[model samples]
Target: MFRRAFWFTAGAAAGVWATTKVNRQLKKLTPESLAAQAADKAIEAGHRLKDFALDVKSGMSQREDELNDALGLHQDPDLPANVTALPGPRRLRAIEQDQNDPTTQFSYNRNEDH
Candidate 1:
């Protein structure tokens, strides 16, 4: 098992060394024309993406405006209706008799003598 692991590690190190050497050679041999071509492709893709985004936003906004108009959300009609009658105020009345009559005596608790 140890022998296998050692050979495997050695093989991996050799492969990495070979890859680094190849990368250095390729970096030194790079042609300016290929780099320019890649840059041009990137710019063209950017313009296409920008156009797509603008079209999507414009279509969405147009649909939103149409819906708002159909719903009449921006319009106001006539005077505002009275909302005071919605929840009627409570009236005070004696359970046994009407409190407005002066003849009715008000009840008093015996504890009030303290």
Candidate 2:
């Protein structure tokens, strides 16, 4: 009777352990868990793409400088890097205070202004 009781207890314990393990595995395979994993992978891929784009832009700038050096196009090494050879687009019209407001009249004298 003691031996049978011991065997039954051991069997019950084994069943519980097996059930817990299977539950954990099933949770990992659930739709919500899978979706979360896929989302994480997608975000990682987007970050990699952004980093690759920045690398490409930097490489292009470096190559542009090298080409300019080979052609002897860079005249002054001391010149400010922010300066550009061409001017940017000009504004077409001056800003007005209000669209419905009538235009103000003004008179100017060249001699008085000077």
Candidate 3:
């Protein structure tokens, strides 16, 4: 009968479609495919993080420049235009001192008098 043949054809088509779908899913679940997918995602995340860091850095520098301009920090009115300020002598001496000296050792004892 024509009705029986039509049903048989439909059933066969359904079976083929299901088999193809299952096969595609199995291919995606394989170890190599899974690893590739994970690697792709990690790379995408890294690129996004890198872009965020660069944006932050640029914004910080732009804000710093704006603040400096607002505060008039670009030039000192008291100092001569030709002369630039240098670090203080006391700070330089402190930085030049030996860091390994025993007298400079830090103490954590709580009972010691000030």
**Which has the better TM-score: candidate 1, or candidate 2?**
2
Candidates' TM-scores?
0.37, 0.51, 0.65
Ranking by TM-score: 3, 2, 1
Shift of residue 73 alpha carbon in model 1, Å: 2.1
RMSD for each of the candidates: 23.4, 12.6, 10.5
lDDT of 3 by residue, 1-114 (tens): 999999999999999999999999999999999999999999999999999999999999799779878877564563345433332555334435634454663322323322
By lDDT rank, best first, the candidates go: 3, 2, 1
lDDT, model 3, position 92: 39
- The TM-score leader among the candidates is 3
lDDT of 1 by residue, 13-33 (tens): 999999999998777567875
lDDT of each: 0.64, 0.68, 0.72
Q: Quick one: RMSD of model 3?
A: 10.5
Question: Could you tell me the lDDT of residue 86 within candidate 2?
Answer: 24
Q: Evaluate residue 101 in candidate 1 and report its C-alpha lDDT on the 0 to 100 scale.
A: 77
The alpha-carbon root-mean-square deviation between model 2 and the true structure, to one decimal in Å, is 12.6
